[model samples]
Target: MPKQITRAYEERLLRIRIMSHTGDKIHIKLPLDFVKRMVKNNALDFLSGKDDIMDSQKLLNLLINAFDYNLTGEIAYLERNNGDIIRLIID
Candidate 1:
């Protein structure tokens, strides 16, 4: 694990809905600024389920060299610099 800097957007953005033992619900929503930032950074395509999504040369390099990669068959990249890390465990 790496030292994670608590991003401001982490508090305002990305949310998760979880159910407690009491059958309560947790609602979470991603921050607008964070989403905008990611789009500006060119990582926003991952937010949308677009298979034909093609990354530019720079984004590719960023994904490979300066970023952490934990790809298992599918390439799932979440913004590490943003609020609440969201992991959509798909079956």
Candidate 2:
């Protein structure tokens, strides 16, 4: 039988959740491979120091690369003045 190979990027997942004051909620989950592709495709270009996205390009890159370090758990948590909450996790 041929030996099977496992990719590091395939073992990681990125999760995001947002809650609004009006009880609205949103959640997203992405595999690291997809995240990598998105980064390569510049899908995150809007996060590059943009005032609305909060200049998160570097932070996002860091999180995406974190798979190399075998990191998991909450990466970020934010609470807005309007009773909104955002959470980012890696699993």
Candidate 3:
């Protein structure tokens, strides 16, 4: 019999948490499609040559920029160790 391969369902959305050394944190959820689109749009500049490198912070900034432009819906929360919490929702 031939070997069979199975494909898993593609993830459509993702949630991530970022924290600073000062104990400040932010939670973000975004659609994978939005990230793909951003990467595609910037591929020319970011992926022009094999020697080019794109860091995670740069990608994070791109996502933040997309949120700023209202390109997609997002939910964000900011938490501080000093008992302060802030919530933001954008669509």
Most TM-score-accurate candidate = 2
Question: lDDT per residue, candidate 1, 1-91, as tens digits?
Answer: 9764444423433333444445555554555446446656877554343442434444444433322232222223343332323332211
Model 1 steric clash total = 7
Which sections of candidate 3 miss by over 4 Å?
1-11, 43-54, 57-91
Estimate the overall C-alpha local distance difference test score of candidate 1.
0.40
Q: Candidate 2 — what's its lDDT?
A: 0.72
Tens-place lDDT per residue, model 3, 1-91, is 9664332224334455555556778777556556556555664242133533435446456555654554533454545454545443333
Better of 1 and 2 by TM-score: 2
Candidate 1 global TM-score: 0.23
> What is candidate 2's TM-score against the reference?
0.70
Better of 1 and 3 by lDDT: 3
Give per-residue CA lDDT, model 2, range 1-91, as digits (tens). Answer: 9764444656767787888789999898889778778887778553343335455776776766675676777888877677878787887
Q: Rank the candidates by lDDT, best first.
A: 2, 3, 1
Q: What is the C-alpha lDDT of each candidate?
A: 0.40, 0.72, 0.49
RMSD of each: 15.1, 7.0, 14.1
Question: Once superposed on the true structure, which residue ranges of model 1 sit more than 4 Å away at CA?
Answer: 1-28, 47-91
